[model samples]
Target: MMTNLQKASLFFLSFLMISIMACSRELSHDDNEEEIIFKEESSTGEPEHYQAVPNDLVLIYDGGAHRRIQWGKEHFAPYVSAEVNGEEKWLFDGFLFLEIHDGRGRGFASGYQAMAARKTEWENLLENYFAKGNGIHALNEQIEEMRKTGRVTGEFEKRKVVLCIPEPIPNQTDWGQLDGRSLQFFRKEDRIDACKWYIDFAEQLFQDANFEHVELVGFYWLAEEATNSRNLAKDVADYVYGKKYDFYWIPYFNSDGYSEWRNLGFNVPYYQPNYFFSESIPYSRLQEACDRARKFQMNMEIEFDDRALKNNGWGYRLTDYLDVYEKNGVFDSLKVAYYQGGDAFYKLSQSEEEADRALYRRIIHLITQRAEEGVD
Candidate 1:
């Protein structure tokens, strides 16, 4: 016969086992709830991947001339909330001029003073216009806002912002043609003076409260009638770099064009080689330019004219362009500027015809392949 104490001990052990099992079941239930909650929140809330770096192909459309605040509102603000290829992309404004353009009424002195006085107002206007409802300050702030809002949804992966400032209005004007020798003598003083003024103005703006977020400033050195594009590039380079400015853009073309600019001791960070047709310039020349730019720690950017593309009747295809770049092996880091505008490429939900689709696919494939190569 078993003792009562033994019976009582067996009952207690069984009860303890039951309690342990119950606790284990509750823990498993809690884990499942946590997973479900995480998934639901991710799916229902805003996207979290909009802040990624953009692809090599940055499409900058011409925004023309307008005040900084007005230009941002009319051009950049709309694109900030747009999604391209399933990801948010940044739109750069090409040919953005924020100058004080006043006629004889105000004169240069008064105009300069007025711009200086209203500088803070202009900055605030641009900030509010670009980053409203999102706690951001400059262009970078607008990008962060896009990321937080998840305004982009599609197949694209990164975002990058670019701002291009062409050469400011030249200071010299002869109003008529002069002999080559005479022209050189007549323009020398004015050219020097113009360079000084531009440098001083840029430096002043840098010190002022207006141009705080300007990452890259482009000084377009037009090689039209100038004795040497290279000389001009060198002079400008000395001025800009003297001010500790790093980023630069140079137009590259045939041997003459490239050599002239090269002679000026200016290194092209972004190469704008203009090649319309396949045979206009040998592929090797383009590659050489890219290699030279790379040696100087600068990336190559190829510019294609929209008019030429259409005139050539190549169906305005982007593949032809990509193929050339890919063949050169520099496609991985090459920056392509699409001249036609934003409609050249289509985003998700927008269907293009079969031909256009093929063109876009080629571009997308090349961009993806290059991006995967991990070249910044």
Candidate 2:
């Protein structure tokens, strides 16, 4: 008995109800108090459509870190060098010098000692990177030596340095403020304050050291995972940006907040496959990591240890990283971070074994090729 218009309206209303129900799916968050609502297409619950907010939340001198960030494809460009008169530029490639935490547990035992230890460590690293007769300098020489014999042609610059920010352990009491009040890292604000102090202190060291062969382009977050310190990460990032320097992070695979690195305010986040150190992890993880990095618009990290320096059974692991990354086109397409376990690369460069030397040269070749590509 209904008219045609009424019938059409009823059908449209039914379809609208079904569509609204379809879009009502919710995403789970670790913090139960807040939730992110977005439209997703698949069962995997990845965002199909969402809003991205530009990171305009500036840190005031009064002090602060995380705010909303908009994700975009443009954020994932190859590492851009900050060049000035052919010297002192940014990083596309970097060597992670892990002097902040000496594995022997003999140094960096406390925030106060860390401060003193890092001063000496910076001197050694600068010397290694620039001073003649060091391993990194020798590697640079080899890069040029190979370049002269190859078809690849381009200019090379000093290696850009990224230093680590020591974590403010909660019990450390020596970290005092401008007001002479000692900071207790038990509170989040105190930890952030300590980080800001470290940045300021490191900047002073860099200015004083005045190394000409390399650039102090940025600082790295020492924590491998973000964990519950999202605000801490963001505040440090904002503070670093305020200083006009880049903030870098290399989150282990599937670590918390790794996918939302941009949102959390890290300028350059690299995905660590974590495959090199563990024998249980398969090579497939390297490709999987590449896929995840591409998905999240992040860079990649190449990990190797002392095992690669000799006839150790684990030497093949380094080769696996090289092969997988090469197959995935990571060398040509993305910025890379080198994680040579505590002086391993330097040892390799100084090795008397031909096999070890060959491995070192191969790495240099790939690095030169990357520089030639003008990956910006």
Candidate 3:
């Protein structure tokens, strides 16, 4: 029964089969992982300096400007981040900065109030609405009610507005004329306390931003002609963020302090060279503006109105602005942003049916052609 040759043959066959099975298992595992490994090697797993893309080239259509257009759609998504009803809009690696409005720069005013020793009251006030949705406006309303009840009071209504158009509003000041004038009931010596308090309050907002759907890139600041708000922005940058964020502002080209804005740590300033107003000036002295921005390492923003492009009765067609940038060779040389929507494509297309779909295609073609040309 114990044949040595037969026993040896059986042992060899068993070993051979085991080896084949093991080899098959290893090959199958390798087949499953090849694509994943290749993708990982291509997309990530290496240290690299981040390069800003056309994504940085955003189209900012605010409530004051593009009131009608909803930007949370595919057609516009390629151009810029949309302001939607819910903050569910998805743009990979997107960012939003609410500035002093939602960020609560006013609550810090209590730090300079006569009851400087009382911290719990103001702390409780901000803690209630510090991180919630539309909390800043809610905070403002609550503060207003508190003022009515005679429990608290602070800055005048005019200073409460963190951001505004460059034009002065009537009835803002004791004298209707607005300039580098602020009426603080407090003595000048207490102002330092207010600034420090404001900076500390803003830091909390930045911390809370980590929990938001759109991460806060930087704290936006208003450079109103009256207050040197730019300096305030710098103080925040120097103190809280340590110049680690992309500081953004839209400066009127004709305004002073263009170069100084860069020095003040405004790394990402957007320029609206053309306006929707009567002038809507075409690019005549554009090189000077481009040079000014380039000197400080910045770029210009291009406007794309969804309003009736039929004749641009207000002035030149918005498309003309893009064309001008492309012709002048700054389309790619400078970081370009596509500012979209003062109106909807449907209204502007004036088509009987399928206006939106048609308008979308037209825009895509224009932008695609421009990109294909490789404006470098």
Off by over 4 Å in 3: 1-54, 57-213, 224-227, 280-288, 304-316, 338-376
lDDT of 2 by residue, 13-85 (tens): 6544534443211321123332111112122522221111111110001000111111111211112222233
lDDT of 3 by residue, 46-109 (tens): 2121222332333332222113333233233332211123321212122221211112222121
State how far residue 348 of model 1 sits from its true place (Å): 12
Q: What TM-score would candidate 3 get against the native?
A: 0.46
Cα misplacement distance, residue 267 of candidate 2 (Å): 1.1
| Model 3 pairs in collision | none
**Full-model lDDT, candidate 2:** 0.54
Candidate 1: C-alpha lDDT:
0.37
RMSD of each: 28.3, 18.0, 27.6
From the highest lDDT down, the ranking of the candidates is: 2, 1, 3
- Model 3, residue 132: displacement in angstroms? 8.4
Using lDDT as the measure, the top candidate is 2
Instruction: Score candidate 3 by lDDT.
Output: 0.37
Better of 1 and 3 by lDDT: 1
Ranking by TM-score: 2, 1, 3
> Would you list the C-alpha lDDT of every candidate in the order shown?
0.37, 0.54, 0.37
Collision pairs in model 1? 53-159, 54-159, 85-154, 85-155, 85-156, 86-153, 86-154, 86-155, 230-264
